[model samples]
Target: MPAAINPPVVLVLGASGLLGRAVHHTLLESLPHGVVVVGTGHSRARGLIPCDVTDETTLREFLAAQAPRVVVNCVAERRPDVVEKEDAKARVLNVRLVEILAEESARLGFYLLHISTDYVFDGTKPPYKPGDDPHPLNAYGEQKLASEKVLRGEDSGERVRPGQGSREEKQGGWDKVWTEVLYGPSADLAESSVTLLARDVLAPLRSSQKKVDDWAARYATHTEDVARVVTAMVDRALTGAGELRGTFHYSSKERSQDLSREEGGEQRPGQGGGRAYTKYSISVLIGEVLGRATKHLEPEASPPEGAPRPQDCELDISALQEALGEEATRSRALRDGLREVLQALAANRMPPPPSSAARLRLLLAGLSARQKSLALPGAFNGLVARAVAHAGFEATYVSGAGVAAGMGLPDVGLAGLEDMTRVIRDVSACSGLPLLADADTGGEGGEGGVRRVVMEYQRAGAAALHVEDQVFPKRCGHLEGKELVPADEFALKVQAAARARDEGQVAGEEGGGNGGLMICARTDARSVVGVEEVIERAKRYVDAGADMIFPEGLCSGDEFLRVSQALKGYNGVNGGEGPYLLANMTEFGKTPLLSVRRMGALGYHATIFPMTLFRWAMRGVLEALEELREGGRVSKTALREGRLLTRQETYELLGYTPGRVWEYPNANAYSRRKGTRRSDFVQEGKEVMEEEDENEASGYGEENPKKK
Candidate 1:
């Protein structure tokens, strides 16, 4: 009988660290059963073999004994601050360890796969290729660069390197992989920069504000992704498909600041290449996931202290893609990866909140259920949006009239796309609820304008928006003298909006999913033409790809029922699928003030109280000013009796905890100085007043008998 053959050994160095553990596990899962995988670390934990690779004598002895066919070098002192503090000791592990490994690989005849960093580049010029000139800015980068030189035969004449020197000079078989900032499941928060920021820095400051660096841009890549790249290369080499012998780059496309070169150095607040998050932005997202307010978490525009970092070191992974194909080089999205880290940290106590896509799907589900007509109160500002969410409503609306009134403008199409989108962003961010915005007449530029509205509204976080058929400088839907665009012209605009929505979904733009941004066509034709004309135009709009129909200025519940019954029965271009119907229940409008139940009874999927909260809020403002003017003092009674929103209530509504130190002096113009407590003002208005019943004081609980 022939002697039993031993399996080819694959050794992993530094297998206890975040990236090392990922590589070890990936190799175990990816390699064939014939391969023997062994992982060694400085410490014996997680079943990793204990060996200090920095010591050349011990490393050589271990490698000789194992006689591994392939060796993956994951050993590095990754933290910049720690590397900066102990340069000599860090150099032993980061640079010298690789030198020894290269020499040993030449002797042992093993293929060496070495992991490097994006820090080798200065970061001023980005999307760095493997052949790009490196200008390391700090000690950590300098050491990693030195290691690369050692592997490339630039360090000494005697040392051998891959893809370089004469055949006689070439000794070791090797490949170098360059990667960027890494984060993944680890033993502790300190193991990764992302988790450290979230758990150590941001989580403890629930009531206080913390400033984070937003200047240095980074591509936060997952370690598991890098590990998979290593695994793929190993598999290819083992199968003789190809040799992994050249310098390659592997990094995530998720960037910190994805602004175009033309956008210049300064980034305006809330503007960037879509969904790219900076460190400050990452903190804000973590706060959102934790249900904490990041209002106080400010962005420091300057560079951070300790260890100089490159501005942007985004790696170009084309080489890896060419070698391993596109699927092997693909990266997980930043938010999705962060969610996994957070879930591990929280022990799965907190599930990720609904994404924009999920919220849009929820809205579509609600519309389809037909159990009740969704009550959508108009939110003119972010605070109002918060109140709407807190009131247990399914969703909210950004009414054109309400937004115009809030901006001190009339509702005759004076407010443009920017004005409506500004409020849409605020409402969506604050409420985290699906929003329906009013795009009045789709602005001034015709079909292009309609497309812009769809794209911008989707970016601004609106789940849906309605474009009206009324002409430019249009009157409110309830007002007289409103002129309608030609039915064909309006249908063209609707088609443009629908096409833009489809394009955005395909491009993976914000709020993109199967439902996408719902395009509702609002026909002001009820007043301009007739009820029959309204129904006919509704069918045309449905054919034009409007997801829903908004019949404006219907004078009675009967007209609403008539339109709903007609549209529901008519089979249009949408393959017999009936469009969701919306009814306007604006105050002082041509339509009667129909209750939610009554709207559902009339077969409408939704009913909008376009100016309800705005009207109520303005009335309170007027009454308060009048009382102050007549009495020469504000009503202490209102404050003491909780008739107005108290400071605590206001903070709670804004997702903030009160009694913390307020850092921004300009945040409250009423405050005398910086760091003033919120309770300081409440202490001044402590005079006792006659308190009303809880329902009356809080303006909740009992329903109004007059409405009934």
Candidate 2:
């Protein structure tokens, strides 16, 4: 049987402070399995003990009872103003309390660790050492130094001069020396200031702001990095890895650029006495990491108000570097340290909504994956879109022919680019499906017209669009007597679509990127020229940066297979793993109605059932109208009854509730129950009215029932 093991308890004093909380979270996330960590603070807080450090009697009793394996003292009277006013209380809290803890550590045989500051030395020195002579100029520093003296036994008396303590004393010849300076949150050299700057930079960066400031400065370590170092040191002591008992110092290194710069520029008297200094500002560093855009930053020769004012507070970490070797320096890398801080900040940060371009790219990428999928046709009107979405379809096809039929017009390219975009927008708002739009010849104006069409469709929240090579007055794919544009002309239109997607005016929310905009090249040449010409045109379109090849009028599985095989070696413009093949399986079209499973077997990645639902809906409407004309009203048969989508179903599909209407007596109550405010819901009424108009104009609205 294995021997029983009592988990070691690590107690952290002042756990409610910024540094303490950082250490607590880090240890909780990164510590070993058998180590238990507890935190105590002066005030009662979640995950913190309300033990007062000034009350030595209660503190001693608590320490004696708990008897933690390791006691890390983070408590101190750090506020300079408070220390200056209440010197006695500061002495008791910072110095005398440390003495009591040191005594307790000896009695309990626990490794006592205390945090000390760099302010123990006057600013006259640059990079002070662990053995540096104390010359604190302020009460806060004096109390901190006094605490260090008592902990080290440099002055064993109950009281000693401020700044008179050293860690040279050990009760049982065990060194208990640990001190820090200018300590704070990781890479948080500029605290709330960085947050405000981040806010100001966000909008401009999104708008492609270009400006760079000539900023430079030293780097700060992340709290997690420092915490890792401390944890490693503790682990070393526990495991007897090396001599970690004696005085040792640790601080993050400066940036390579800061180090490479000459240190012999100029120095003011009383600044420091190490070397002639060349301290550059760090605005560039903040700009580069925080905003991800350096041009937006404007550098200045002098430090701005409330900027990093110190000429140099660099610490010599050679001793620590030599002790831990690579492990010590690895975690303190400046870029990694900065990222760690940003990552932590982002965890607490609520990110802005994703841009339309990003959403489009993600949808395209999802479609390009190895799995085969079907593109079920949805009406241009919001009515059919809701029905399609409720039917559990993954994606929706906004077919030009389907839209023309919904508008009660022939599919003769009657709707302009703007009209189609409006239909796409209406459908997109009501349905959660990623829409694949049909951009026939990209609207009249040659390549430039095609570019605008592609840009506008992406802006209208279309995930993908197929630009066909049909002539100006192009008919529906299933219709006879369709004229085809020349191969080169079609290829230019494809290139223009690609260019618009990649270099067009992307929305501000999306930032500038061609990603998430899927472009497919649809060739109508299969019917006009032949299957061979369609394959040839598709290859040309692929080379022109089309993401997928949509071959129109494929008569059979054999025709679809031949086209897929010819494009086997071709890759998408976006560096996709393989070529994407989209087969149009429109009912009453040249292509046969093949299931998604059958399409996959023929090497087709996606199949579109464009006009399938529209054909069924039109047949049902014709029968219902005939029944109304003959029987004095629509028949109450299964076909007519099923066609009548209930008012409740329509409301539910439109994401509406009776409590949403302001006229409802309990409208506010419903908002409260949903944890939403009425103000946030005010715009919902307008959107619903807009959707109703769109449906009515498209002749799909069945009038929602009036409330009683």
Candidate 3:
């Protein structure tokens, strides 16, 4: 009788990580019946054979014991931050380990499928073919590129090639595969960016805002897709059907769409799955899948901090497609992949919407506990607010003047409740910072108007709103001819605003008082009446339930101090919490420009840089216009010199991801509902199409007149 033939052994190193686990599972499911698969991991807890690939003795011993036909090497420190922090250690695993594997493969004659990264490229120019010159930006990429060199024999001066023998005899050799931004099932969410985002970023968005990098373009590939490709290559190599050699790129391509029916015969890059995504866009997709509002997630348009990352290291996968066909190289859509991940994470439970009241409380706490005055820079629009947030301001100010100027109107109360509320909503949405909006004179409709303005601003998500004592059609507090209403009448309006805020608070809600909305009463009486009367009216406003006082148009630091002292003294006398004192440090204002520290030292809680950014922005616009008119065009050199916001910077500021759909956090619920209905409609349509096809095949519709 013929001796029993043993099955070929396939070894998977680093089988505990996101990619390793996937490749191991895929080989188990896809390989021919006689192929035996063995997975080894550094840790025994994951049920993988405890074998540290970094230990040359242990690895070689394991290899000799298994006598494997194929070795899928998935071990590497992939985190850019970790790799940067521990360069020497990472190099040992990333490069040295590969060198060992290559040597082992050449000797043992086992096919080695090594995993690489798209980070081998500098990412400046993308769709990088395998032959493209490598220029890694960070230590992680540098090490990955080094490992590839080792495999290609450039480092060792001995090209590692497949062993020449019979198909059955030459079961082991070496090849390299590159992939990008892998994400899929893992025991730990931190193992993959996609899972980390779902579990860490989107899940906790209710209490805190998160900033995700939206500048770097990434092709998020699912680990499962990569696993299938690895399995297929291994199967081919073992079966001797094909030879897998050279460096190959494997990435999840954005799905192609048929644009033949599209108007203008053109389709946007974001309309299909072939498009790259920024981290922000990925977060948006995750949010949609989780049914969570992404309003609390701000897109950082700039490159992320820590290790340097490539901007767009999109790998060109033509080699993989050519070798395996389109179906084999195809990847799951990002959303669909995320849905699977989210399901594994928490059964796809939706996180609660971010709380506006919580943001207001954050502002209040910041003002109350700040060692220095909280500087609130005025943001006229959402873009400006995003800039403010990026600048690291604790809170933002929606200046009435800034808003009015943006609308091409004068700051004479022409920007009414609707106007101010519009800006408030925009700034709140974009900045994700506590906002203090300017409500001039609380509109012209007296106490009722004041109440309406308060409610509207509160609903618009303003953490605080300040109503000045100046009459309707009010002049800029710093400008001349500013008139104040009667102290009693203005006090009534302040009382009405405060009451409206309190009434709007939801009962039984956490930190519910006034829904965390602060009503700051601004006394313009410093210019109209006197500093003494300014203090008097401020006291009256506070007594009428104002949460803060803005002493507008105070001419000197002495006056600011006096008003602040008076308010503090009044609070002492009243024996309860006193209203926060706010100082206006607007440029060219009657008030002297005081540093935030100086204001804090003088007992002020907050300071507003109203119109500061707006003024600077306007000056920039004028300069650009003048340069254009004089030179017939602005010089590219001038533009590149950081004199203007770059197109990429503008996109970042706007949180606009090119080649992706715009995600509105506020409309997430509607979008999810619509998506469900659309999916159902498509499924139903497919069913109908199937029925019609069956009838056609059965001749049911061809001659129904005989039955009739």
Candidate 4:
């Protein structure tokens, strides 16, 4: 059955921020249908409809404009010093904005999502939970706690009811209904710049007995994890399984240390009682949010007293773990992440590969199950992840087709390495699959070229990559229009890729250098030379240290069988330790799509899936764009549903608050967006140069379309 009608239109107030962007990305990929997500801000996005969160009039206008069913707020600033110094400004954003967004959501009968901070609790207890009382230490945390009280509070002082608390046709005020922080992400990497400086300066000196940089890692949230929570929430809401609301922690799922029990069940006296505040062992207000531990300073006999030694930051994040899922939990397991990332780089792969995972396993696991077997280095990307999820699949293919065809752009190296990296990042985000991507000509010519490309790819994440010895304007793997860079140069590139792949894996002091990029040397020699010489060049290429060989443009089954048998022997002097080879079988290309099981039966270990996602993505985007133009509003149907955002939704993501000058509409300001004067106005035009079409000027239905 289809999801019911009247799906909530989530309005995001601020759509641009680390967490906001991450959340938006998650929503786009995971949310269900019937969810309308609109956005509001100074800018617009593919799935976001912009609006101003601080402007009550504009907020209402947009609210009525989209008739939102939900409004999520992830915006906040709980910095104590910032708040104390600018309390008035801070309240506008952190406190006032929350009330405003909530009120609007309630008026429209939409679910309100407001993301809060961990700073709400003072350092009075250890392992504070959600139900614990909160006694904020500073202005920022206090304000955050205060806002929570407002949401949970009964009508009291300054309730601002219309006509003096006697309800009679109210215009705008507050609401009692709201959702709480369901999850959050790594906060250690950000907002703790100060903490990091100290650690960097303190830790090294302590190590050398020379001097230490004052710095320490903190327990904070990862934006990616936060996004997962948002998506999960949407999924639950769409499925009618979302009962968890109010204030829920959006942290990890690890079992945290139990809260310490003192006389007041707290160490500090000023802290209030019974608010369910989360308490870490020590002060959780270290440098970053998900820094992960409480810091301790290395005590030395008073530190030589010159420039005082820097202090370590004190922070923790175990409380967050108890609330997140396994995958979403923050792990210190950097090795696994690095390994998966390295494998992807070596394979030259992408996700949504050529053949389905099942087929790949059946036809292309390895080249011939007999004595002549094709060895495939581990693959990475979505293919492997999908195979694991679906089961029964063994071989992997990279999505070059998805990259090219999906963008509706030619795959002739037009999209730079960054484009490819972005695809791999998304594909690798969840799928722990090993993949081989199509790296045209090692991204240049020489081995140095290979090193540069492979190094970056490793950082971006890939199992392996295929660097075809092809010239400029390289055609599709199965197409005829292509040329090869000299075999020797290509061979050098392959070796370089091998080196880079290794370095990338052991990043950060352990790997000697920044090694860990992997490369699969590919050769189109088969297509150019007749069948026999193909083996000759393949041998020379393999001799030059190719991790895996991708011999493109092989014909029929007989041809595949022979090629598979040709390069069967010859390993480097390291005994049988030679590079593994793979097969490229793309449908509608020169090569026929061999089943993975069949390939495995033959001699191919892995299959390269290029251009699949690119094609599908292109078709979908083109269709969606055309529909939006015709309808005057973008279609949320084709978009990853449940993730569709509205204006209010954006605000939360951007950490929007009434204090943010960019947000509020002002009747008093002389230099505000809504004030008497304007700081800057967007230069909207057809082509950043062309004016709106003349047809748009004459109030045509296409331009303004009357309200139904």
Candidate 5:
């Protein structure tokens, strides 16, 4: 029998960092529905928390109110020189904030699981195990190791010296003795993750006008892998509480750097003293957080796919495995770690793009100038959409057979409505132009088939859908082995599709509460029978109120020319007929890539490029993977040299920094001003009496108290 799946609420601190973000993604995917995973971080966390992490009073209140089963802290300074300089900054985070988290989380018997790194162990030992003693050479390593000691305490369940400050301060860091009541005051230290990151990373990148692309290419960590693991383990670890005390060293990959203090002089940490040092340290942390960490995840997997073996900082999981099982143990390997890092980074990478609402819409006009002209058959993707809106083509074609071939699936109408919707959604998101999606012989199911097809395509964000008069499992257009639906049934389906399209409105959250789908009734009747029969079918469809008429397979451009001439002369079908015409242009297929000017001349209203993005994405991944395989390790160095944008260059472009990254001569020092606000989360740890009434207030709305 399997272990019964029981997961509780897990609170993740710094839920926006490479590691913390990864954990958030992982947990969301692994846990069953209703398993709570509340995330917290400063407003700078992108959007996770509305306040700062250093505000102890609010941080405590927030935790106490949530009353989660477990608290996992993935927060850290991550910068060496900054911590090395003012040391207090590092202590405040690496050591102090953790103490605060543990004490606050303890309110509801929350057991804590925090991530510490191998930097704690100086490279003196090869593959340091859980028991290996640490002797850190850098400021980052030293502070983390020190913080671990502070978290563990003098002995489990006993009073220990404070993580920060002299004996006089009395309260700060995770140093609170577990048994003591936490409602106390002390002189507080103040520093926010935002400030640290700004001077170090954002400031510099902004200087370069926010050109981080170069910076990101170098130094990649698999944040995705971390997200998967934490997302999976948080609840399990939180299940059992009481007497749980210790630091969990997460970095388990092969070692880097030497134990000797003077090794790897890449950059002098405290170059111009403490102030300069702080800047340098913060800069590195910023790169780690912003650039690669924010990649889009899409959706995460369980023990997510493509895990790499032998990754960063090897973690000792013998105890965890013993306590849990082999599955958990196996997941602790390097590959698992890499997968987590990758997934997290990918998830985080998704840019907060613009969506919804209408605007003037930006367009590229030139040879792509919006000029009206002619269109050929076969418009299925990106090129088509571009042609429709900006290329000035009268109509673009979408072929049913082409759609199937693009997916690498059989064209025998095997592609379902859902599949079509997905592809169309992506195309629509990419293409702002009008679209004419293929509905291949109406649809798969039955009566009112055209209604079903039209409804779905409209919801899929399509401007139009084409329904052909063909039988079930209709063969590809322009291909043999095709059959036809009863002419009458086909006629009804076309009417339904047309009615669906003509309605023209968006649906409510509930299905079918808006303007109906736009329908383009297609006639396969032309090629099968004579021109007269096809013409008759077209007339009937028009009578049924089709938004447009698609007559498949005309022989040549002259035939098209003849039809357009005839339509102008005809009297029936919605007055003289010049319906929308589509031309599908696919790679290695029928039509070739045509310039917008040429497409306009051809009378094509639009074109589509469905496979362009997928092809590019796949190629990039494979090349990167191959490079990793051949080179032993993925290098952080950019393909081209020259400062690799150095955190500052990337920041400079944004024009959203404090003066400039290099202006202070040191990125880390608190040179700008005094009176800077402490992270809202840490305000609880401050002396209450000293605070003004306004200072004591918490959260976004001071007037509205948070509900417990």
Candidate 6:
């Protein structure tokens, strides 16, 4: 029987790296509902915490907070030249980090899968089997070799110093330790699984039916299947019901076929008869997968000059099969995995520069150049952001008012910098849209404070922020009795924010680029100092490096038109015709709620419906509670039509498959058995004649193994 395992919360370190990205994609594709995949790195593309794995304290704090059941460490400083030059940094990253991870893994009872490289072995021998003695010839290889020791008890001398404590007194000195080793190109460490290799890596090709004549050294694995094995191991570990507490090596299962068979050969791909599985020469496998003729695929007899790389470092996975069961040997065919890579290459033949900053820059350019483009930001949190993204909004917004209301507080300066930033992060994770956040007087601190607030919001993945000219205890823009700070003082705060944004850009901080830190300077001065002063403040704010001009609390259409016309000819960040305008259409606001069409006619670029959704949700909640008070029971009619999102729609919004994947085998193809050509659900006692006939034709079946 399958174990009753809840989907585990998994964390992938170095998610921006090649191997890490593949693992991240596999987890998202294969894991069932309730599985949380937190991928973190020091890159904006990672879309999570800007984490540095070398900082033990920061890593510890993150681990404690997340408390993940599985931590996949895909981080390594593997560049030999860099490591040799800075051995201290390399040791801190590659060696010391593993020690800390093992300690934490034991204490936290989480499974750790640290990715080590094939560089741990020198190229003196061909087909260096698993468990062979490592003879590293470089600084990079030394660090990886040392990390393997740290996982086992071999490198525990520093922890168990003389007279410091008894062996058993140490925190992670328990005998029940689980360790696993994988050599060359396990799905856990293969770069090719996620990226398309350049043509040079697969050139000088020939097409032939026969296998290659020469022998060369290379290793590869299908990571998609490997990910499944790892997930299973993690699940069992979480239940504490597995005897898999020891080292094991994982590598691809090799198979060879008579390629001389014609295109219409009796045997199809992945079909085997009496032929035993045998390792294919690296040249033959590469030629077959890449569609290159065997004659053109040459194998190098020796390593290239100055390139210290292992040759024929093939891992023996017999132990891995025993530990992970028969499924470990059922890896996908090399041709199939290569087809995926080829497809990606064909689709992205001339791939554009990919980064969050680049995307945001394009989004900004589009929004600015398009005459009177409108966006509606109503996301209260990440979940709502998903729904909002599906609703087809060009951009998202984090409303300070909505954040305060979500926390069951009034928008009277209650949402601090961190609180709003947390909301921004959550919202950013669920949507790819560039977000504009509301910053209330840059979070209430004085003197060089708005700059820090700007930096924090930028780090949280906000594309733009609007800092209003409000006093310390700022109220909602639509609310009565709102007060404003002096125009010059507010301008200084705007300048500080601009400087902070510029500095971040220079340092290559997250969100720091062409569309980086967009400052939308807002003025509530119309109520405090009348129209002329409001116009003057808007001009000064733009002069202080504001990207967009937000004139809050406009009383009429004529007033909004005046503000828009006054800001014309002002060069915003994206070099648009005029400063982008933001119009807030809050319910019960002083300004009438205008349609996006009318707002555009008045020259407003973006319109925000900040508190509309929250108010609507609360009204429904109150009415439902009142109904429960009167009826004291549940009824079908109680939930009005379209009152809430349907389960199917919610599932679609959350990126979930339509059916229960665990119960429905065909719901997710990734969960199916390896080498199974067809994914289908069979009714009980119902014979699938088509599949049976295909299996019989291929000379393979459950009851009979066909002979050649």
* Number of the top TM-score candidate: 3
Q: What is the lDDT ranking, best to worst?
A: 1, 3, 6, 2, 4, 5
lDDT of 5 by residue, 202-304 (tens): 1211222322111101112244434444443554443432132343333222211112123444532212121211122223433343332222112121221
Per-candidate Cα lDDT values, in order, are 0.73, 0.60, 0.71, 0.46, 0.44, 0.60
Using lDDT as the measure, the top candidate is 1
Distance from true location, Cα of 305 in model 2, Å: 49
TM-scores of the candidates in the order shown: 0.47, 0.46, 0.48, 0.37, 0.35, 0.47
Residue by residue across 463-558, what tens digits does model 1's lDDT show? 788988987879988888999999999999999888888776334345443447888899988888899989989989988888789989898878
The clash count of every prediction, one per candidate, is: 0, 16, 10, 169, 131, 5
Residue 8 alpha-carbon offset, candidate 1, angstroms: 53
- Model 6 clash pairs? 187-223, 206-292, 206-293, 207-293, 208-293
TM-score, predicted candidate 2 vs. hidden true structure: 0.46
Estimate candidate 5's alpha-carbon lDDT, on a 0 to 1 scale.
0.44
- Looking at model 6, how many pairs of residues clash? 5
Q: Lowest summed-lDDT stretch of 10 residues in model 4?
A: 699-708
lDDT of 3 by residue, 178-215 (tens): 99998886433566776666543333235667788878
Which of candidates 1 and 3 reaches a greater lDDT? 1
Cα deviation at 280, candidate 5, in Å, is 22
Q: What is the lDDT of candidate 1?
A: 0.73
lDDT for 463 (candidate 5) = 46
Write one digit per residue (lDDT tens) for candidate 4, span 330-381: 4422222222322222231211111111122222212222222322222233
Please write out the lDDT profile of model 6 over residues 462-575, one tens digit for every residue. Answer: 778888888878877767787788888888888888888877733434544344677889998888778788888888888888878888888999998888777776654334
